[model samples]
Target chain A: MAMKERLTKADEAKPWYGELPVESLYTAGIAGEKFFRSIQEKGVFLGSKCHKCNMVYVPPKIYCEQDFEKLEDYVEVADCGSLESFTCVHIGLDGKRLLEPMIVGLINLDGASTSIVHMLGETTVEELCMGMRVCAVFKPKNKREGAITDILYFKPTKQ
Target chain B: MGNRVAIVGAGMTKFVRRAQETGKELCYEAAKMALDSCDMNLDQIDAVALGTAPDTFDGVHMKGEYLSDGAGAFGKPYMRSYVGGGTGVFSVAQGWYHIASGLMDTCLVICEEKMSSYRPHPQGAFLTIFDHTTERPLKPNLLWIFALEMNRYMSTYGLRKEDIALVAVKNKNNALDHPCAQIAKAVTVKDILNSEVLAWPVQRLDVSPVSDGAVALILTNETIARRVTNKPVWIEGVGWSLETSYWTNRDLCYPRYVEEAARMAYKMAGVTCPRQQIHVAEPYDPFDYKELHHMEGLMLCGKGEAPQMTVDGITQRDGELPVCPSGGLLGVGNPIAAAGLMKVAELFWQLRGEAGKRQIARKPKRGVAQAWGDLMQVGTVVVVGI
Candidate 1:
């Protein structure tokens, strides 16, 4: 008999449930704090450069992964980026279809050796293309919190 | 037996309530200091062993892999050791087996913890350590467990609260000489008994503070040890024991698991008398009574007699037998895994005569460091000698 033929329907199955009762207050680390602070106060992107690895990391790190060298050289990264890849999610975490498809993009910021994954905005899935140029859409200055969400989403830039 | 293993270098960062650096950065700093201590780099290290507590403490899942590269494990054989809080000293055993098994010529052992990342207080994270089906519903935190154990130990031996409080006094005073000590204050027994009681019999002053830090050590085979440094502290023996998870059923007064683990290490180290052979001791002391509890488990004294040693000044650094000469988790700050390794690092420093002011009285021939954790279910012991 096929394995699929012996499957039980979701409604017929019983499962016990428990949630992890843990709340975290993570420190922004030395470099992460500076990066978030720069975005919150100066409205600039902060990055760290590893001279030994010849790599630049957006959302800077304290140490380089390849060489284990201390990465103290901070740089200002360009707010604009090129979309490396992206996905449009039709289903939500609760196993229900979303009212509107949410688009997420992996973007490589200028002067950065790495990319950041963030929500995409102002464009449909059909219009999204690889290597598409996008600019950061930040929230109001007064509402700025030291968090990645301070930049609401990435908007597609006009040609 | 496998090839003999020795710890050639040890290094650690200053223990703190909250650290500004990331977990990886803490690992890098300690790893670099350890490697630099022996004037060697990552090239000489064949592998890396990392030890850390629960992922909730740092808010990073798979913490071992995230913090591995910075511990000088880049493009090298890397492994993580875990035994709840016993991970720190167990990490040394991991490195020992690597070289002793003839797999790696040199291994770097690293332990790191950042409890401040947990919101409100770090103790909330330990709430999950209780059995979800049984104890979690009771909302029993660490203090409650220690209070229960302390009360049991006191009642079993008919000891006084004042006698138990002396352990805190002696350890905090010992920490005064340690540069990395966090809460090293010389408070009297009256102060401890008068301090705010979080749980009955478990005062605020009786407990170690939540902390963040990292420690690293370099271990190698006998052949490599000969060339590394003049004073290489040999790993005489290592042992660990884990009792059943049903801690409710066990007798709280005595830790049978600790005695079993200590006996195993003593057998391997060929020591019949721990009190006579072991020069110095560093037992886990997150609470004042724990130092005494673990000492009795390690067979250093009769059950309920450790407090008398503390009161008699016998455990003093200049006395007959020095215990927690590094201030232990009580005064040194407890970062879980990092605190355990801190004891082993103290043993290394003491055995090599490198511990400046905190060094014990005589030129010690041997020393033992032990760590206990996880609802009082496990005990890890490591014996080191010059």
Candidate 2:
């Protein structure tokens, strides 16, 4: 007689558990909303320049982190900056694809002391470097909205 | 402080890959055990602090609310605090504040995680830890970050992979004596080297396995502690600090946040030199290299000196400073939140001379448990002394 085989509960149960509700419209604070709007208008992405330390924050905030004091509005920043760090992702949550084999880089926006996280497009993994200059590519003017996706990605520019 | 706070009771469920009970049920089990150990009931707890890491694990938002009743927080002052893997010790630190501040005489602290609920792979939830715009686009696995840190540590210190593999071997060997250990095995550096590689340098054995479990502690002021138990482990100091979220911009070779937090904790505990003052330590070890990383951060040893101590057996169970005598996250299991609290529980047991076979050879007067979490930059430290 053939030996009997037993199945574990997990083997018998449903493979997938539950799904998280996905939403497109991510709500940001007033300061964050304005930062996104500035990018959509082709104006330099500006942040509050700390008068105390002369530090420039790319995403303008209500208060300075270092001094915990209210920040003053500053001028627009240049589009070009150098890449600080990057990684190439192959897998995603829920076995879904945001973009296959996408390369993401942390680009230090010009005129800002700190770097802003953004996608790196139209660049090969081998071409990426720590201090490579790149410029933000904005969406079409008609399709522009107050969102981070307004600036599609950063691409290497010939300086 | 009006009255000193001490952990009067501690309890935990059996750590496992998957549990038949739900997350709430696991919490209730641990809470019931803690209350039972103290000969007290839910009504005696003045406030409840629940700690769990990442809502992605349980597939529920505001997990504290879902677990409130089971954690004995119904109609009571309740707050949920989280700092990634450091959440468990952070929960205990919050509980200490309630008693020390004279706001509450007794507090029930619960730490639970149900990672098994995430089907197929718990690694799925880790994808969200990256920067949504840039890093997330790369689809990097959580192991990649640890691999990067391990590589940096190795290159800076000129350490070999075998030296780090010994940590996994020792920790797993120690877990054999723990009743709640999830993956306790007696293996060697060869076994670790032979294990499948997840990312470069980080093998399957080098990383902690995902687990589901719960741990709870009942803390009370000195007055209530005397009434509850003859032996109570006093919480001498608590400190926590967070570095910038810009982890990529900072040096990954060492954890400065942990060192800063440890300094604050040791100062309050009146510890002049941690090497001589601390008898045992439970540094967070979600990854094998993390144990060495935190050892330096906690000042148990100077920077770039921990690997030497491990190689010299100075960190062994019988050595000068027995680190992770509870088998740590490496051997025990990595349930994130519960893992940190489990370290505190180990100290409670060790200081009281109740660790059974896993007890250190030397008598312990003071023990420290530290945890690191959140984008490789937050450190939470707790000092408990007899």
Candidate 3:
């Protein structure tokens, strides 16, 4: 009787469920434009070297973050690098692991100051370990879209 | 600082997984309680500082301006500060500056987070917290980063899964005494290890539940504080810092930003040795391992000594250097920014000898509450005393 009396709202009426539609297109700006363009055209990695601090930033920056000086030198960085840290993930964004378990790693590119996070391919989770050398596998030139995705996952360079 | 600032009152809503009350309503409830506790009116407050995490979870843009009315911020010098998860303590820090700088005699700090409003699981909102161009394409579920960090921490420290499980057991048990705890349960290490693994190192029981809540603290200059309340918790020091957003660039084993922030606060608080000087600590513990990670960062002990401290009963409510006596985010809920403010409120209650059942066994003179967030970048620390 108490429960029935407490039911003021109709059972059929549901809480409103709506979404905030967000559509965003961001320009790479001065630094990112050059980095993505280089990946699109040359399939090479370019790091911006700060003259003041001498810190090279991969996926280069127009200005130095630390010293606030313009980064003038463009240095080439190798795609082959060592894995700093990694994890074997079983779940996707949908909350279910319908696909195979994926291994992702933070790969510090050679001659670059910062590491980039990307998927690890052509290797098993058991064999994956930090400090293992890996090289980037790029998508075919025609299919490249001037994005970080130009380099398809990274694979172990050696056992 | 021009003048000393102290916290005259504190208040918080019951942390829950979901709430019928909207964000503004939550803010109003906490703000009203804080004002009532100090026997002050809305008009008496000189300024207001608000803290809330990303707008993505609330589904409202410019949340500061939107929630201002309910937070008693109508036509006043209102400011909002955010550093991802560090927003709560950071807002309190901002409030302290308002009074200490002789700008405002009385300042109100309010933190609110309504995470339940985000549809399709609130974790879905965190998908955008990662790097949009490089990392977002990898399709990460927030758990991946936690698991990765936990794995790196364990491997570097030579720790087992059971070592960190002790934090979850202790915090949840401590939450049993909290009046507004969300998921306080007397769990064990076995229960945590047996819980379903969302990611490799992270389990269901090891993580704090998503929550909806708000907390408020009333800060005033020493003169105003003495007039407002007989017992006031003084804000001794505040420090905050952020590491590079390029999280992968640095080693995840140690939170350098947390250490830097703690060092800065300790220097200001005149705490030569945190382990001996600080009586209690509530470092951010959204994940069980994070508590241990933050203890190390706070210089409570050496790099790998936190897990052992938890194991040896040194961090118990009755133990020396009691940690997370308020049940922390693990036993309490994780509403992001609100969670941090809740820790600060616990310190206020604890220092004033007013925390009924959750009071520390050893009467504490000083305590530290800290928060860390933003892709493992930001650290906010506050030292409080009676």
The top-ranked prediction according to DockQ is: 1
lDDT of 1 by residue, A4-111 (tens): 654368866544345666777777778889999999998899999999878998879877877666789999999998999999999999999999999999999989
Worst window of 10 by summed lDDT in candidate 2 chain B: B19-28
For candidate 1, the per-residue lDDT at B117 reads 91
Per-candidate DockQ versus the true complex?
Answer: 0.51, 0.01, 0.01
Q: Please, what are the lDDT tens digits per residue for candidate 3 over residues B1-386?
A: 46899999988899998865667667877887888899887768999999999887887789999788668787789988889999988998999888888989999899999887777688877887777667776777889988999999999989999989999999999999999999867998999999998998999998999998999999998888889899999998899999998888988999999999999889889899999999999999999999999999999999999999999999999999999999999999999999999999999999999899998868999999999988889999999988
TM, every model: 0.93, 0.71, 0.71
Query: lDDT for model 2, on a 0 to 1 scale?
Result: 0.86
Best by lDDT: 1
- Please count the clashing residue pairs in each candidate, in the order shown: 0, 2, 0
Q: How high is the lDDT of residue A76 in model 1?
A: 97
- Report the C-alpha lDDT of model 1 over B1-386, residue by residue, as the tens digit: 58899999988999999998888888988988898898877878999999999898998899999898778888999988878888898888888899989999999999999999988788877887777766766667777878988999999999988999989988888898899988868888999999998998889988988999999999999988899898999999888998888877888998888898899888888889999999999998989999999999999999888888888998989988999999888888999999999999999999888899997769898999999887678999999988
**Interface C-alpha RMSD after superposing true interface residues, each candidate, one decimal:** 2.0, 16.7, 17.5
Q: Could you give the DockQ of candidate 1?
A: 0.51
Could you tell which candidate, 1 or 2, scores higher by DockQ? 1
User: How much TM-score does chain B earn in each model?
Assistant: 0.98, 0.99, 0.99
**Which residue pairs collide, candidate 2?**
A89-B138, A89-B139
Q: Judging by TM-score, tell me the better candidate of 1 and 2.
A: 1
